[model samples]
Structure formats: structure tokens, C-alpha cells
Target: MVSTRTPGFSRPRGRFTGRTRTPAPTSAGPSSRPDRPRLGLISRDVPRQRRENTFPPTPDRLNPAHLASLRSVQLLGCAIAAGWAAAFPIISDLPNQRLWGAVAAPAYALAGLLCLILPRRFAARSAAAVGLLGAVLVPLALLALQGRHQSEVMVVERSAHLLLTTGSPYLQHPVVVTDYDPYLPAMTLFGMPRQLLGNGDALTRVAGDARIWFALTFLACLLASWRLLRPSRDRAPLLPLAVLTASPLIALALAVGGVDLPLIGVCCLAMALAERDRTVGAGLVLALACTLKWTAWPALPVAVLLLWRLYGRRPAARTGLIAVGVSLAVILPSALTRADALREQVVRFPLGLTAIRTPAGSPLPGKVLAGFGPTGHTVSLALMTMGGIGVAIWLLARPPVSAIAAADLLAAGLAIAFMLAPAGRFGYLALPVVLVIWPRMAARRWSGKPPVPPGPVGRRPRPERPEPALPRG
Candidate 1:
């Protein structure tokens, strides 16, 4: 060895040869390792890679001025909605007057400011709870203002009395008992809850009953919001929840006992159940929603989509079964008790009415758009119907099983289209429509990564070959 050749050079190592031999890698399968290097941030202990992925190339995560602008817009909407709600109180003849109107305006303004200042830092559930608490106390405040003897429920008492005592739901004259409207029977049946509460003056009893229903509606919406906003076990971020809960339109809707509140809860529950593969539960919740309001029928496509996804391509039969069951559950008892009454009230009443007035026209953007034409209701409804059909098709065409984001978009879009409906009552339209849309809009904004390019199904990515080990010298 000392003669010149090195120890290993003297004789080739095991499995190697001196005559231009090439080495093979020891491992057969591809390396189970990431292609990229990880970079970590020292001070914060936060991984730089995740932070970079979430934030765009822009220097600021969220521009403070942009957030302030959003807040300002929301405050303006709150003011307008509060003013509208205060100036004209429909549903019940209760008057809000300027004092309560002022209360709502400032309350909403402050609430909106809070939302603005916090950005993504705010606890939305807590804020929504606070808002709901304020809404519940509104009735008590109104009771105190109007005196216990003069309640909003009492306003409708005379009409309620005629139905309760004589099996009729309406009065022929101010207080005269008559069977002019058959629909009164069903209304009478539903109104029984109020009658059971107490025997007070007509206005007091009627107002009290309405108040109770309204309160229940408010509570339902509040709870629904809380549930929707709760942190999921997956630890997925909830930007959608924040956007929805913080929306000014939703806040305004909660200010009054808006009918859409219960509908929102029902729809949310239905979607949640459907997402969990609880078909029957979803159907029943949707049916309950239908009984509360006819507008809930718009969610039929979503229900059908869920059914199809659960049962595969041959889903029509299953969907039909669910539909028949839910329909029977919702309509059977009501039809039996008040078939004639419903016909008279819903059908004949519209024919008899010479005018359809909004009390005051709706403040929502949809109303404004429809107002361009004389037959706003027809036009608005047409647009909504068309949009709904389109959305249904799209949703069904590509049913998402694990992706809540896709499902939420479909539901929320439908809700917005409904608000754009020309005939929607102001109390009914604005809030629910906005809540659904806000989440989707925010999600689109927050998702920093670009959408993935579509690839052929089942195509496997090819491995990149390693560079030839530089020819050893």
C-alpha cells in the first residue's frame, strides 16, 4: 500500500468495480420527503411558511383605512335601517317613536364601530349575544313605555276575541262577530297560544301574543348565529362566520322581530343536518320552515342536491319520498284544520284587495332595482326565480360532500336572490339575505391561494429525476 495506491483505491469496495461502474441508489421507492425547504420565524415562534401562504404579497395584512371604510358603510346602513324601522312599525301597530328610533340608531352605530375596530380580533358570538340581549329587552322597554294596561297585543285583541269565542279568526266589523272569512278558523287555531296566556284588554292580549312570538323569533336567530359562529373541532378558521355575524343588515333585522329570523335558523339547521348526512332531520327542519313562511320553499334545490349526493345518481325517488313526507307533515294538519280558511285568506283576499302597498317601500337594493318598473313584484320575483333555478342546477351538478364552503355559498346566494325579490316585506327581506351573502363574499376575499388548475381525473404527477451526481473527479 505504501508503494503508491491508497487503501480503498488499491481494491474496489464491496459491490463496486474499478472498470467505469455506476452506483445505484439504495432505496427503490421515491423519497418520502417534501420538495421545498421550511423557513421558520425566530421571535414569534410562528412558521413563516404558513404566514406567507395566508397573506398576499401586500405589505399589510389588512389596511386599517379599508377596514374603517367598511365600518363607515355598515354604520350608514344601520342608520338607514334603524330610521326606516322606527319611522314605520308594521306587523303590529306598535309605535317606535323618535326616542327608540334614536336608541336603535346609536346602538347600531356603536355596535358597528366595535366591529370595525376589532377586524378579525373580535369575538363575534359575544357581540351577537349582546345584540340579542338588547333585542329581547326591547319589548320590556316598550311595555314599560306603553304601560302594562296598554300593550301591543291588545291592539289585535278584538279580532282575536271574535275568533276565540265564536270559532272565527276575524271580526265582520270593528268588534262585531261574523263568519265572513273561513281562513279565520286556522288563524284562530294558531292564535290560541295567545289566548291561553291571559285574559286582558284586546290590545294588551294581542300585543302580548305578538310580542311573545316575536321574542321567540329573536331568540332563535340569536342562538342560530351563535351556533354558526362557534369554533369547529377541526380548528378551521371562521372568516365566513365573522362576516355573516358582523353584517349590518343582519343586525338591523334582529332589531325588530323580523319573520326572517326563524327562517334563517331553520335553513341553517337544515344545511347543517344535510351536511352531516341526516336527511330526515334536514327535511323536517325545512318543512318546519315552510310552515312558518312560504319563502322557505326556495331551498328545495339544496335539499334535492343533498338527497342526490347521499343516494348517488339515482336520487329522484329518494328525493320524492322526502318531499312527500315533509309536505305531508307540514300541510296535513293545517289543511285539515283550515283548508277552506287558507283558500279564502290566501287566494280570495289577494283578489279582493284593490291595492298592494308596502306601507313604505323596502330599503333593500333589490327593491330599488325592481322599482325601475311599474310591476316591481312580478319583475323581482321573475329575476329571483331565474337566479334560483340557475343556482339549483349548478349546486346539483357538482355536489360537495366534505366542503361546507361550497354548500354555504349555494344557500347564501339563494337567500340574497330572495331579498332582491320586489314583493318582499322590508321586515322580511334585508337581514337574512345579507347574512348569507356576506360569508361567501368574505371567504372569496380571505382565501389567499389561487384556485387550483383542473387536472384530468386519476392522472398521476410524474416524479422529477434527480440531477446526475456530478461526475466524481
Candidate 2:
């Protein structure tokens, strides 16, 4: 990188050789001219300064060695992920006795190893592309290959079939049964693909729908990563993209049927848009994501606060109001139809609490916090408070990142709270948490001032040798 600090600001070399002047000191004593200070107004007629001609060419995006190293690193990560997915038969098993764990195994392995080995610049771009493609293709493949194997994926298919074939909304009512989970409603909208396909088992249709959703979400994540990393201005966590893409939890969400992928994609979109100064868009995205899964609500506050920080309080307030107004316009209809049902599912059922059990049947952190109870509306409230504190401190120490990190960290904390709560479902939320840390763990390309190399102990900078004046000709 070229030095940002320009030279010749301190002293001119041979530029002033042809034109020079001497200043006389101000008169003192009896003839003192105090009003006219002896400040130098020296003039120089020299026009051919050497410093003016010095212009280093712009550097290439990345050196060949760097790119090669990144590729190797990514290759190794894929290998390890593949090995783990293959060797660990316990976790990699598919829902219906099918096992395509082998495919994911390599993809994840490559991701992990590349994260460790590749340089930040190359890794960020590569991981973004790979992660996005892997997220989309892997899920599609699983859904296509293993239809009706998983219960939720089956539910999604059945829901679509009931809607399409029977022309009945009752199928939608089944999703109401799990109102505590709003993702089903969002999934319902994409039944167009299933409508095209003739009567197949509910399993096949849902799988198809799911595959598309996963693909879309993956594409969103990929786009976000690319947009965030392309300019490479500030320090962004590249590893986060890898983690977001390659986490086993994400794979599990795809293998089974869950809202994690969609929520993740929306969250990413919101953050990216916010960074680009599209607060209204970010707010709408966050609002839509929250509708899919209440877990995304934390992002709302974070986004608002970030807007406030980025653009003064008044503008931030306006943005927040607009976002809320738009979100309600979109979500209010669905929520209204099932107002009583939603109340029973979300509020009365203590959907407000985090007593949900993990896959292994352990109480998530949110559950424990929920035990604190009535004082806080839900575990999200408590977790949000804690996460908010940490975020506030971080922002105070250093300004908030385009609000993306704030949203991400909130998600990570929420995931942890869910895991620690009495009934945390590790399957769906774990991936978001894992993804939140990816950028922090991975190195990013630096585009600021060039770094200073370590000098010998206690040694000072040596004086630059002055060039000898050319012989008079």
C-alpha cells in the first residue's frame, strides 16, 4: 500500500533552488517597527518540484501468492468439514434415515480450513461466494433427495398442498397450531412452486418450497457479504460470513425445516441496507424478519439506535417511525386474522418466555432468565437489556459499525440466551450466533495507512540521505 501521508510537506528539496529570497529582521531599538512584524513572505518562482512528479501506480487487488494461499486454505477447510461430517455419524444423520451428510461434510470442512489459512481479502470474497452457493444448493439437494423424511419439512409441504389442491385455508390453520413459531406463515407465501407441481406427497412439495427459501436466503447472505467486503474500507469480520455459511446448525436448519435460514437472511439484508444508508429498507427487512421469527426483534432496537447514532436523533426517530409504520402495514393483517390465536400462542402460551427446550432437552439461558419472570416481559427483554449494555459500551469505546454488527451481536446474544434458557432449541438459533462471530474471527483486508514495521529495540528512524545537487551545466 502507498503511504497515505504525503511527502514534501515539511521541506522542499531542489524545487526552490532557482528562486530564493532573504528576509531582514524587524528594526529594533530607537527605530523599532513593532507594527510590522518580520514574518517571512518569501516568494519562489520555481515550478518544477520533484515531489509533484512522484505518483506511485495503484496496486492490484491481490497478489498472486495471496490468492493462491487463500485457495489452498479454503480447500483445506472443505476437507476438514467433510471429514467431520462423514466421520461423525451421530450428528450428520438425515431426518428420514437418508444420509447426504457426506456432501455437506466437505463443504463445511473446506470453509473452516480456508478461514484459518487464507488471507482476509481473498477469503472474504471466496467464502461469501462459496457460503452462499453451499447454503442454497445443499438445502435444495437435501429437500429434493429426502422428501417427507423430516416432520417440519413434511408440514410445510402438507400446508402447501392443503392450500393448493383443496383450496382450503384450513391447512394454514395447522400452522396456527404452532403459532409460537411464526416462520410457517412466511413459508406459506412461497407455495407458488408447489402449485405448479401436480399432487405429490406433502413431503415433496414442502421440500421443494424449502429448497427455494433456503436458496433465496443463501443468495441474500452472499450478496450482503460481497457488498460489505467489495470496497474493503473498514475492518469487517470476514470469518463471520464463513461461519454464517458453514455452521452445522445452519445445515441442521436446512436438513429439518426451520426459520433460522430465512431469519438469518433477513437480518443480513437489514444490516447491509442500513450500512448503505437505506434505513427505511433496513427497517422494513428487519420488521419482516421479526414477523417470521420474533427472535429477530432485537434487531429493531439496534437498528434504530444505530440510525440515531449515524444520523442525528431527529432523523433517526423519523426513520424508526417510518419503519414501524411500514412493518405494521405488512404484518398487521396476518397477525390480526389470528389475534386471539397469536395471543394464545405468543403471549398466553408464554411464547413470551424462553422456556423452550434445546434439542437435547436442556433449558436455554433465556429460560433461566425467564424464571426471573414478571419483571421482564420475556427472556428476549432481559437478553436484549444485557446485550444492549455490552453494545452500548462497545459503541461508546468505538463508534457502532454500520449497525450490522450491533444487529448481529444482538442475535448472537439472543441465541446464547435461548441456549441457556430452560427450553432452548439449539437446532435453529445456533447458526445465527455462530455467524455473528465469523467477521470478528476472520482477518480483513486493511486499506488505511500502511502499517509500521517493527524497528530494532529502542532504535530511532534514520535520517533520509539528502540527494546531491546536480553539477552546474
Leading candidate by TM-score: 2
Which candidate leads in lDDT?
A: 2
Give the per-residue lDDT of model 1 (tens digit) for 1-473: 12333333333222211123333332226573342112211112434443323322211235322443454555564455445535534333435433334445444555555655666445333343434434334543554344442222343343356555754444333221122332222223234555665547655554455444543654454344334422222233344343343343444343333335555655555555554555665566656655554455655556656556655644524544675576676456546665655555443432222133233355665677656765665666667767777766766676644214434545556556646665344555443554344323323332312233222212223333443444334
Off by over 4 Å in 1: 1-94, 97-99, 109-136, 143-193, 199-208, 211-231, 234-256, 310-323, 333-340, 347-360, 363-422, 431-473
Candidate lDDT values, in order: 0.45, 0.50
